[model samples]
Target: LGIGGVRLLRALGLNPQVFHMNEGHSAFLGLERVRELVAEGYAFPVALELARAGALFTTHTPVPAGHDAFPLDLVERYLGGFWEKMGTDREGFLALGLEEKPWGKVFSMSNLALRTSAQAGGVSRLHGEVSREMFHHLWPELLREEVPIGHITNGVHTWTFLHPRLRRHYAEVFGPDWLRHPEDPATWRVEGLGEEFWRIHRDLRAELVREVRSRLYEQRRRNGESPSRLRQAERVLDPEALTIGFARRFATYKRAVLLFKDPERLLRILQGPYPVQFVFAGKAHPKDEPGKAYLQELVAKIKEFGLEDRMVVLEDYDMYLARVLVHGSDVWLNTPRRPMEASGTSGMKAALNGVLNLSVLDGWWAEAYNGKNGFAIGDERVYENEEAQDVADAQALYDVLEGEVLPLFYAKGPEGYSSGWLSMVHESLRTVGPRFSAARMVREYLALYQKGQEWAGKARGEQEVLRAFHQALPAFYGLALRVEVPGDLTLNGEPLRARAYLEGEVPKVLRPFLEVQLVVCRA
Candidate 1:
């Protein structure tokens, strides 16, 4: 369908260039290209093989459940004629997991991805490793060591996350040179400037918080939300209070319950003289009714626990609110199970604005965290049993807050505001902030794209540039699968004939694989 859609879009005269296949949903673009070539009278073999170099495929799914697939009947109905045209006998198509998929009933999107693309990758280093092993069945030519799946860890856009004025303040103080040489000698020099600089950073954070709070309140009023609660939220807004923001899709894996793990501890922090507060927001997919209910339950907890003054679960979150939460929060809290998260751009947003992370040892945090900068929810929960992990993680979060976070926020140096908070802010920037921005990510991509293009060639580049793609393979191998019949030769127990791709002529030894096309199948 996507292949058809891409073809339609091109026919509409939009001159679109470069199709980024977010996932397998757009794999049909490859099919579309093949269709285009065929329409122009080029053979299927030339089109499919030639189109490989230009396209780039990035796989977001590390798990089998993540890929899309369709039943054999369904495939035949849509592209069955196309497959027949390409000479894909049952065994050859099945060899590529186009049939009899144990992962799913239908051909997997990941399977299609590995087989179809010249260049393919996972979203992060760990994911890349997982993906390589997962697809080892297909690339028997390459050992696990030789597999070609690459990695491009996700990153947040720095300019999008950091406050423009605060960023400019840093820019002004350090000069535009700071962007190029974030780790430069002069950049580190700014750390030594005592109290005055810390005051400026904190003041900027406070003002940004005000802007976000006003925006949220106004939006709520426009939506006809309770005016009294909106006013109450306004009154509760304290630029000076230790604010924590927890916002993301309400997946059960994110462990949203970590906040209530130790009811007494959390209540103490909220009830304390300084008054810590958390602003929560996120959406569950419309189909994930359970996850949506979990979010609603969290809202009920706010009322049940009388956390109305301290906790607010804003409903119907979107990109606009995301900006406010990441920019305004003193700390960004994320507690998903280990490795489930591929990469979290939200934490990166929080990092650039000097918001510390209180997160699990997963996602981008796995690479960026140091114990000194902020807190990781657990030490070995990343490697623990489910029950043990939950208990340990719950405790780990409490320890960081009660033992570390509270003291640092409220601590006053003998010399005052310059001492404690200033130290944490400076350390977080040096350790977490600079290392995770998009500028660093883009440089990694440029290198990857260049190398892939060289191997893929000019035709590959054109597809990537133009978003046009191949519809089918030109001379790809196809294998025949059949069951045995006693005293009779059978192809998968059906009347047997097979086809295989060979360099020149079909051979008997490879009859298990046939180069001859199956012109028909008997019932």
Candidate 2:
């Protein structure tokens, strides 16, 4: 994919000054660029430096084990001849990605991208810090704070995720150009439109209920269930109930079964005075047995509790189902283990449509939660073990559901709608709409691209400086260096001063290339 992507660009007469690699999956494009430069008469080292200067890498995986690696022999078998063409031996090429793993020494794609990119970033602020620590060994001379990895928090395309009815409503309230300036919070502040907003939301919820019922009925028919069972599927979820949506890849860290920790307590909440139902839709990776087990457990628990009518898991989750859930649900639920979730964007999509998020204080929510806009599962405290963390977070989820979320949702005004809930919906729209829009994300990336172009230009100019220095080597042979230090260099409360100067004539362009350093040591 990586090699073909680069060649395709060249074939189309498109020359991009900077290449932004979304993940290690595309790290091979860097090697292809180096090969192209080598074929154009540049030495391997110079080509590598040029490629590194122009490339930018963004790593989305926070866990070390999540990275892609291959056995040494497998890499040698496929890329053996490719490396030789770059004027490097097999060992030298393998050293670019060589790392020690529990299994054995392997070639890591992430390590290659990091080594071949001038700029690297993560998908969120916390992720950036996590990545710095994860790859700190690569820059042993620098502190963790000085690591070059930065973050550009992921965002969603607002219009694509926003419900069509709500989009037209906004177009009428604000001008048609409202979407053009989605990064501005003022664009979402629709004063005195509370009742209309609630009406549109209710209509969307009804639409979602119809879609869910149709899907459930079709699924039951495929399973060869009785005609009576298929008829019962049409009445699964309540349209008027407080619906909570949980949809994502059923990874274990996401804790898809967290709500089922205490079946009785969950039952009480589901059968409480206020109506509440859950709609779950996701698919586990085919190879992940644990993830598949979680999915099976969710279905089994729904049957065991005899709450099939209140809780429904939609099969074959896709973009169409995701849009329905995000647009029609009263609340969006995300319960991933803290710090393990690398900037989830589904919650952003839901929040863009005024669906209040109930999530752990991780990923973008860690930074977006302002105490009033949404509900947080727990404080930012990770326990010593996963089991303890799950217990605490699950308890917190129940507490928020019973103590805060339920009350605010059921607190209706004289006009027959929850005014407090509307306030939170407004807050979510005002905050998330501007900050988490694709416009802002793209703007941040454009800034990074500009910086990458500057780095590449500087690298090319440095090569020019090297050539000039070689041509003027005879004149530079007589150059001398002189240093001056303050006479009162002491341990007072002020910084000591020092200066260095070239004691011979130097070319105008070469003056900026000279650098000086001062080293301090403990006696």
Top lDDT prediction, candidate number: 2
How much is 290 displaced in model 1, in angstroms?
1.9
lDDT of 2 at 208: 90
What is the alpha-carbon lDDT for the whole of candidate 2? Answer: 0.88
- The lDDT per prediction is 0.67, 0.88
Question: For candidate 1, what is the total of clashing residue pairs?
Answer: 22
Model 1 agreement with the true structure over 86-167: per-residue lDDT tens digits: 4445544433436345456576666665665677777677677777887776778666855878778786666667676667
TM-scores, each model vs. reference: 0.76, 0.89
Candidate 2 C-alpha lDDT tens digits along 1-523: 3878999999999988899887666988888888888797766677777888899999999999999999999988888798877756787788778888877999999998988898999999889988999999788867787788999999999889989898988888777889998988878865645888889988888999999999999999999999998999999888888999999999999999999988888988888888899999999999999999999999999999998898999999999999999999999999999899989999999987779999999999999999999999999997879999998998999999999898889898887789889888888888898999999999999998998899888877787664465566667657887878878456858787888887889876666766666765556
Badly placed stretches (over 4 Å) of model 1 are: 1-20, 33-50, 84-104, 133-147, 180-197, 204-231, 271-274, 380-385, 414-420, 458-523
Error of 2 at 281 (Å): 0.5
The pairs that clash in candidate 2 are none
